[model samples]
Target: MAEDGAAGGRPCPICEEPLYKRHCKYVCPQHGVIMDCADTFWN
Candidate 1:
């Protein structure tokens, strides 16, 4: 399910779809919030 306040902006590197930022965190619709992606995203 889509996250609340997740308007869509950054695309997920894996799915290539828009990711939702909730509480300064990102979540993929298929995979949910990937912990490994944290470093890649912030860096």
Candidate 2:
């Protein structure tokens, strides 16, 4: 089964680990927040 908030199985550019969706952004556990969403600008 897939993880909740997982970013469509996309790998992190820094560590090659799976990215997770959190706070409207993609995060890498090892690297912290990796990418942010456009909606984040309003939050």
lDDT of each: 0.66, 0.72
Worst 10 residues of 1 by lDDT: 34-43
Clashes of each: 0, 0
Question: Candidate 1 at 29: error in angstroms?
Answer: 0.7
For candidate 1, lDDT tens digit of each residue in 1-43?
Answer: 4455464767787988887776646777887884333566464
lDDT of 1: 0.66
How far does residue 38 in candidate 2 sit from its true spot (Å)?
A: 1.9
Give, for candidate 2, the lowest lDDT window spanning 10 residues.
Answer: 1-10
lDDT of 2 by residue, 1-43 (tens): 3455756555788889988877657788899888776755423
Best by TM-score: 2
lDDT of 2 at 15: 89
- Pull out the clashing pairs in model 2: none
RMSD values for the candidates in order, in angstroms, are 4.9, 5.1
Error of 2 at 10 (Å): 1.4
